[model samples]
Target: MRLAVSALLLALVATPAAAHFQEILPSDDVLPEGGTVTIDLVFTHPMERGPTMDMARPARVGVMANGAVRDLTPAIEEKKVDGKSAWTLSDTLQEPGAAVYFVEPQPYWEQAEKKWITHYSKVIVDSYASGEGWDAMVGLPVEIEPLVRPTGLWTGNLFRGIVRNDGKPVPFAEIEVEWVNDGSVTTPNEAFITQVIKADGNGVFAYAMPHAGWWGFAALIDGPKTKAPDGSEADSELGGLIWVKASDMSAASKLLIKQ
Candidate 1:
């Protein structure tokens, strides 16, 4: 894998933290009327809501919809967040189906941990309420197969998925969860920043989102050990990341309390 020359070069010895999350966020996750959607590709600490990292030009970006794959690499535009490199892809939905947009980003050299990080991230957008393709696997090297439908989820709903490595279930995988914070919420401690969970014996993990907004689940595994940028040996970290949104239940769906 080609390492991103522009990744955040960690020269100083920083404190240990594991909140980096690769994001493939869309303007809208479910489009009932069908229109344009702008997807933002960012690498940051979503729960912290700041300190975005620079992301080099991705290796590949594409979408799977209507049983066909569409290469979207040429359409991605460079966008900066916190004065750091990022990307955005805008597309108009014309079909009544789910578009699974995914990206394979260039490997980032994390000098703090002395490892190479390669996170393959993806998100699903349902156009015109089409739910036929939300579960379609993009066949990523490391991927999360959604057991529960990923789209049109209500707030506080439980999400379930299986972590897979090369199309095979991982017996026990470590998954990190984080919610996209909009500055409206605050955490009392660092432990609340990134929620960590482990997959069951069969590689199935479940998370119930308590609030509304986008949630990211990343399953991490140790990749092949190789030489680092300095020609020294280092371990590689491979992550399979997926994002899903949840909305609050409408008041009409609530029942009146009989006083």
Candidate 2:
């Protein structure tokens, strides 16, 4: 199963035709306080049409926190987006509480002169502190517990699952999904389906299926394979299968996965 999924992902190396530059990180309205946060930008183009042109020059990222602007050129990494080379910038969040940030392709640069630029993306920060004793008691400690949630009907097009780490809700973990239809398995890249969205600041994930039928949906979280004290690792096979029925989507469904 792992090999099949990996092959499917690798098949997506071809670049999409009409590339659209967008921000992929700092997507949440609230972020945990106190830690280095990395934001990534994703450039997407239409794969069905033709390849998007490679960026001739490097792009720039502009970061603003509490009315202070900082140039993020040093942390920029050049990489391929939808098969075309693109630029990415990563930045860290300091201090506590909420802040706003944005990213844009450098307009003054020679290459970005004629290219279309993306709108600014916003980010909100929430308090996250690490300590011990009474402070630890007030601070949110990591918990790895089972999650029980409703699947909202056996809609063959949807799969729902609960996520947790060390008995606590795991917010912000990535969830990748694939489906097995009849005797054929759909790869992540080949499957004409929407991406599985991870749970919010609370461990929860859901995805809509592409087709109706007896499909076996599998999920792999970018967490640890073995159980850990703090519940952090790339454990994909932790949460199991989710069954759905297209015709009976109106009926409420429930799912429970234990870690």
Candidate 3:
């Protein structure tokens, strides 16, 4: 019995750390004409795209567009993914400007890590050629204020953002990046599962995504110490996550270009 217990402990330690990302994916990040946009909120290992966890009702859900902020929490609906709870909503972008949607998810208890995770996730959507307000800050506890516009991105463009906590730059912040794998690509090793990077002295980091798909950037930071439901003291992981989708340049379209 002792030998079996020891083997169990060893196996637990050998398991790869799965990176958790809160995703606020939209049907279309850019709506040329003012229309409805559907958003999906889920807590999952996005890179692998399975084993989704139950996401409790978000503490707050809102959008900032055309210099105005509106609470959207009341419209969110509960759903299930992989037998786990998720949330979904729809919003109409009537104004012609960049709409920034933000969510503050309820703390999630992670059994394997023995901690609670809370991610403040946001995404930017553009409408009607109005290229303004893409970098507006919604005052999340932790947030990535984009230095470059988040929308209308090409696959090879460099994405830049400054990691901030309480409106102050967090120097040397650690960020984990992953591209949602559609099973079209494979990773040979564990290192390729999540690409890690650190912010420079100014709390700014940039990464150029190589593939044409949804990419998630998660800035991890230690948050207020909290306790688990089991009455055990546990650490809190606060993640400021942003999701961006890059589009590929079609070869046929390129060949037909007048230039």
Candidate 4:
């Protein structure tokens, strides 16, 4: 009996546990200027620990350019994913050059709480040049597509979602889900579950929930868009939010199950 118990323990140890949070972006590279970029921040946390944990809070994202780090205050738009609340940050580059930027979640939790933790990401900025004659160049506006929220049900109390863009799916996009119980509204880093997911095909992706609750989801999509020189009409690369409910499936899924 002892040997059997030891074997079971070893098996459990071999299994990989879920991470606490993640960042979703289209690519590690960005343009130096004349473009806008959007990033989605997804967080996952435990709900059984009471409503003291709030996963909703405003965060500041910073970019590294030249030899110094610059704080990027993008326009944040809020949306709901599968009934959970989420937000997106959009910003534009104004300079021309190549540099790396770091995106970090700032002051998301109270100082009194030592359990609060933060995360970060690195972004590359490319040079932007335009002129006439031999140097005559056509510039494309950069736009990052949004990541799709996870869907479907599975055993082991796990839920997953995929991140995709412009009909094409990207692999290893950062994703984070935060569970904030039923009646709470705030952001506490201790209550976040984050992970990175790679796309399979047809722009598909997935992630596993630690348990379940009202989870706020977010992701980042980056790329370029083309426009007329007049700037009257143009095509935009899309980026936005995706939300999913684990406790309940969509009507389409329900219908299929009934069928």
CA lDDT, every prediction? Answer: 0.91, 0.39, 0.91, 0.40
Output the number of the TM-score-best candidate: 3
How do the predictions measure up, each by TM-score?
Answer: 0.90, 0.34, 0.93, 0.33
Better of 3 and 4 by lDDT: 3
Off by over 4 Å in 1: 1-15, 250-259
Give per-residue CA lDDT, model 4, range 53-125, as digits (tens). 2336446555544455556546556655445555566655566644333344442332332223443333333
Deviation from native of the Cα of residue 83 in model 4, angstroms: 4.1
- lDDT by residue for model 1 over 164-211, one digit each (tens)? 999999988999999999888899977788899999999999999988
Per-model root-mean-square deviation over C-alphas:
7.2, 19.3, 2.8, 17.9
Q: Which stretches of model 3 miss by more than 4 angstroms?
A: 1-11, 251-259
| Candidate 3 C-alpha error for residue 256, in Å | 9.5
The candidate 1 region of ten consecutive residues with least summed lDDT is: 5-14
Question: Can you tell me which runs of candidate 2 are displaced by over 4 Å?
Answer: 1-21, 27-30, 45-59, 106-122, 125-259
TM-score of 2: 0.34
Structural RMSD, model 2: 19.3
Better of 2 and 4 by lDDT: 4
**Which candidate model has the greater lDDT, 1 or 2?**
1
User: Which residue pairs of candidate 1 clash?
Assistant: none
